[model samples]
Target: MARRSDDAEQLLLPYPTTRRQRLEHLAHRAGGIARRVLRFVLRWLARILLPLLCAAALLQAFPYQATVQGVPFEVQGSLFTRPGLTADTTLGSWEFPDVSGVPFGVHVRPEDVDVLELTRLAGRDLPGFVEELRVDFAAEVPRIAWWLVAELVVGLAVGLAIAIALEMAVRHLRGRPRREHEVRQRLLQFGAAALVTLVVAAYGVLSYNENWVRESRLTGTLAAAQLFPGQLSSYYTEQSKAFDVLGSVVGIQAALQADIDDERTPDTAVRIMTISDMHLAATYPLVAQYAANYDVDLIVNAGDESAFGTSAEFTPEYRQAIADLAATTPMVWVAGNHDSPATVAIMRGIPGVTVLGTKTAVEDGFAVGAGVVEAFGLTIAGLPDPRVYGGPGAYGADAPDVVDPLQRAAVREALGMDDDEDGATDGGAADGENGGDGGAADGGAEGDPAGVDLFVLHEPAAADEVRELLPGQVRQTVSGHTHRQNASDELQDDDAAIELVEGTTGAGGLDNIVRGTERPPIAFSIESVSADCQFTRIVRFSIESAGPAADLGTDPATPQAYGDDVTVSTVYFRPQDVAEGRRCDTDLGVGAERPWADAG
Candidate 1:
């Protein structure tokens, strides 16, 4: 009992008041508080940071589609890695090489542009249109920024929910009770995984940039190089050549314009500017500038203005541009092989533009004597390409506007169709006279109120047939299907119509941009007619290469010679010269073989 009492006394004795023991107790309490605070901070940080990172990763993995200015585009979040704008130019996907190292990429889906949109866009000039786009993009920045922010907020909310669900799923899979230490471990694991992923992605991107993108300078189509065999080297070479030619094109154009500006037109002369085979090449601006400089009174487009005679090519914008061009000077157009019946219909709809065939003849898709129309005090007639009319001898779609044979005959007769019993065309001249001299007579010349002043067709081969059909009525004949410039008074019998063949004013169409082939010079013909409707002169303007597409010599001082050839040559017409009357100071005819040819 005494021992028991003694132990109780010891227990009740004043707890040892040692300072070391008190210090040890305080340290243990402090450590517990610090651990709680650290766990709370780490938990919140993981919730926010993990979700944010996940949202960013998701955005980088997907692309967004949007349309601007009626054009479709694909936006990719590159995370400031590969910033660039690419365009589907039909020929190829072209990434603008100048813009790189940005956070995002935009790809223009040109294929998505409908006919109407294409037409609208087609009418806009390049420089001005680009400026407008720049302004529009700048104005849209705030909206785009706000949109991105909203996307981020939504993505963050989604990410947070997904992370919470995943955390619950992991706990369930482990079949373990939730613990503060486990949460900390998860946060650390997630951080490590994210860092490793970032490093791997960065390394891959760096490798790709070094191996392909940067080495190639981003000039050629990257897809083409990767997908097509034998395209890598050839494409780059072409691109290099193309960039080299641009400066030359500008310089050549300027020089040609200067020469044209210096040329004088006679006060009494009626100037006729001829262009053809545009093929939707965006050559109108250049043509318009040249026409304005020349002060042309009439503009004639021989044919091939449309590509494949598609309705899409005749957009409102394109039509408006044509109309604007016509507003400055009257325009006459003949149907070429490429100008379908529908294409012709569209052209006819444009104001200030005259589709040469008579209304009835056009409806029949044939060129008859009645198609003559008076413009600029001159009687002009056109022959539609027979190939565009479907039937026995024709090779095209049977048009809705085409009339039956009876109606066609009546229309032709009403307009002056002369058919003999043999079913061959006879007495087809504007006048009752069957055949007369082709020369333009003074007052009663064939082109007066009674005759056709200018006979126009699409192919040069058809000129002989037209001159035969029109006889002495046609003063001059024009054609352009050959995409070559030529002037000749074939047969030289003082009765042959002088044929003027203009070249491809569209510089061989827009495909030439990618063809990378040496192309013929852009050319146009200027026909100066006397006050009496007589042909005075035909001047040919052309831009060609001054020399081969290389340095003239091996010498370093020898400048590379390419696209410096700009020429303007005049061919004079003398109505009275008995044999081969047309004369040019330079050799400028079809084969450069006119008897009167002089290399001026």
Candidate 2:
């Protein structure tokens, strides 16, 4: 009865008897649980994580390899082999000595491997698996290697911390007094192991830069080294010498290769071919062939068919080419600086050719200058070279030049728009009446004239003045005389126009011949226009020189000329008809419904 009463009294005394004793008892229970958990984790690290880390390090240090055709090759991922064939053939003998008599260690790629055979050996679709592995290897190898090192460091730190915690917990649970010196000793040993692990990780990263460990099968006979002195010293030096010799011979061979099939056929409703500055070279046959093959509807020559605009310069060959072109397709000619009065008359004499002169007139709200030819469902205006009126020489006598400000005002008067009035230039009756079905008004500019679709001339420098004469309505202007081919930026401003400068088509006469650069940069444009006066596509054609100077018989000092190589490309423009809810396929019929009339 007394023992039972004593046990009840002790149980009711809060068990630990004091606050400090109660706290110690709770800590002992927690330490025991922590120790058990730490031991399990330590076992896992030893049995699983440690082995994985070692294996990864070993694989990275020495990559796996396979024998192909009796030649050992280092496998790059699963699909490729290291040291490509070019490197092996060029540097193998010297860099990798052939210890064995037979040439071994030749480079191989995945494509060279027999997938069927590999699959048979592995009894599965090894090639497909290998392909997937290759992609993963390329993307993840570098990241994975660094991740492995990071894992090692983190695992070591965590393991050491847990080990120290477990030791403390064990001592506390066993009712042993904490030994500070023994704990310090255990910590020092674990810390040293962690430090050693960190050092190994750093060394492993550095060792990745070293070449893979492999025995060289090639024997170092040095036979080729003895035969070709200085060849093995630098691979680049040998390559440089070889390319230099090849370059000298390449120029001549390139000149002979001509490719006319490269010309691009227009994919538009209406096709207009624009050629300029033909200074009387034998390019008309090629030009005629291009037009006929592509089924060109119209041909526009911006001028300079002769050097001095002399009658004698129009040789039989030149005339014959022009006659043949006009025979098949209707052509329009604008006078150039080089075209004299005699030259103009000769061109006008051609049955299908219409020659333009200098004058000012207005159609719709926009002023139409002299040489306005309405054909192929569009209005084409032209300006003669300003040099023909007052600049520098005898070239001015044959044709009058009206590029001055006063002449431009006259153009306004012809369009029936008063100067300085600044009246709105859109949605006017005269705009619709001038060209009738032949013209289409600018949808953006109200009360403005339908305006000219294309302005043809011999000098691109006159574009600014021309734009001033026909504000907000000139879509494009074609010109030549600089003997260069280039197009201006698209008309982005409300009143800007595109200026296309045609390069020399006749190879620039003596300038090209004397320099031995007879083949010149010649370009023609295939333009597609919608029935409602919108352009859909403007494809530019030009010749690119594929051969070197020696082949073209050009002087080494002379610049390379465009020859047989032809490149076709397109230029973008705002679609006018498409925006107006009109289809581009609307047929406007062939030829004029009535007799052709000039905008006078």
Candidate 3:
């Protein structure tokens, strides 16, 4: 009994004497081996992998050689301080590839590389090369830094997942039921070491493929260029080319000069070109060119220079373009309905441009009437559009009536007529001969006189009232509110005065987009008038078949559109004969009247 009790106590002792105890001992040994293996990996990562990752990051931040369009180029520096390239220039110096050598037009540094220089070096025109250089230099450091950070994050995540998976598999094979605390501790250490190793490997691999990095840097540098200088001269050149091409397509080139028989001096023959409702279209340069080419003595605009009349609509560029035109010839501006007070102020500020505002009043109702500008021995009067008095702030009223007694009184004052002794207005037959009132008689009419030689207004509807108030001495009337060329045809039968309506010169706000198969035509008229205002001749030219309308394919408002392209021809009319008993003739012949008149 004593021997059996002693044997049982021995069996219960902490020793591998039974099968279950032996299996537990084997699991303990395997765990010890796994711990040593994990320690080795952690030490290796700290010693070898961490330093490698740091080195790779440093290398990525440095400058390197890149091939751009088959030519070797060096890319360096950050944005602002050290931007641009190192290239050959005969005009400037060259030095080290540093920020100090950037081209700021400083005499102490090397010349800055430009698109033109790059084109010369590559033997090809690189359109956007300069812009590409600007963008790449500005964005390089940030882009690379972001890419490296992303790779590091991904590598670390992948490595941790792999380490945890391996640890789980080993525990399964060893047949050890992992305790929660032990599993968590082992995973943390192994995952940390694996993460370091993978991050280092990924960075090293990326650094080894240096060619790919260089090529990526050069991607945008080798493409076609799209940027150009925004200087005024550059703007004019580009706009001029586009306008010239469009004009040629629409036959404006053919209608530049007039076929006239008169041989008067520049002083005797006043050549006037009328344009109106330009609405900020891209056609100003073309109009200016035509005026210059035709040697126009006076240019008249009937307003609508801006569509919305906002200050933004009148850019410095637009003012410069107008100044360019005013520099070439005398221009008269009449305020249209679209013109705001700001627009008037801008026009008044332009040198050599005559702005006929409401202050240039000859009479009460004619407060907006411009007095007179005597050019080519003729007195020309200007009247602002009556609608100018009805807007928000101009006349202090909305839609005020203008075609009434007040306008008649203003017309009478403009014509230099006076009230009779009985308070009835005189017919002004004597005033027409005596040059009565403040009216100047310097024109060819001289002592044999009359009222103003030419009357310029905004709307054609006021033509009859103005002529009726005149002393029968006014030769021709010019207006532009109606965008159509044939707006004069709707005048009352008793309105025998020769009225010329200048059509929309700036495409009636068609903008760059033209629609439909039927093109809109622009009219440019050259009027050759004697200083006496008698024997007036007008040569009208049209630019037809320009292009499709803005809503051609999408909207049906302008079907059969020609887009400003039409046959180029000239129509001549003599206002003197037309004012008399004779009819208006396109050929200015005695019997052959205009076809439109014959149709009625």
**Best model per lDDT:** 1
Residues 1-600 of candidate 2 have per-residue lDDT tens digits of 999999999888866878999999899989999988998787546534454444344433444344532223443211112221111221222122221222112232233444334334333443444444345444544554454345445555555556566657866998989786886787676667767665654654554422221112211112122212222234223334443222212211112111111223224667788888777766676567667656777888888776765688888767877898889877878777666566777887877777765422123211223545556556566655533322343223332353344334533443345556543232232232334334433233223343666777776645555566555556677787666677423332344346677777665665455446555656666666654456655556665433443466643222222343343444445443222432223244223212112442
- Superposed by TM-score, candidate 1 places the C-alpha of residue 323 at a distance from the truth, in angstroms, of 1.7
**Tens digits of lDDT, candidate 1, 1-600:** 999999989986655468887787788889999987986776567666666666566555544565655556554443343444444432234343323332444444443545345335634354444445556656666665565545545555666656666666756897977776876875675566557546654754554432111111111232222222232234335445542233222222223223332223333357788888877754565566566656677788887777677688777766777888887777888777666767888888877777765222354354432244445445455665554423333434334244223234433342343564222233333442222222222233432323455767776656655555445555677887666686332312465447678888766664344346566677787777654445656656665534332234322111112232344544555552121221221111111110100100
In model 1, where is the ten-residue run with the lowest total lDDT?
591-600
Note the clash tally of each candidate. Answer: 6, 22, 30
- Among all windows of ten consecutive residues in candidate 2, which has the lowest summed lDDT? 252-261
TM-score ranking from best candidate downward: 2, 3, 1
Off by over 4 Å in 3: 1-268, 357-367, 389-440, 447-449, 487-497, 510-520, 531-535, 545-564, 567-569, 575-600
Can you tell me which runs of candidate 2 are displaced by over 4 Å?
1-267, 358-369, 388-432, 441-449, 487-497, 511-520, 544-562, 577-600
- How do the residues 378-456 of candidate 3 rate in per-residue lDDT, one tens digit apiece? 4456666544333433232222264444444444444345554321133322233222222234222344333445667
Q: Where is model 3 poorest over a 10-residue stretch in terms of lDDT?
A: 218-227
Please estimate how well model 3 matches the true structure, expressed as its whole-model Cα lDDT: 0.47
When 2 and 3 are scored with lDDT, the better candidate is 2
Which portions of model 1 miss their true places by more than 4 Å? 1-267, 358-370, 389-429, 432-450, 487-493, 510-518, 545-564, 576-600
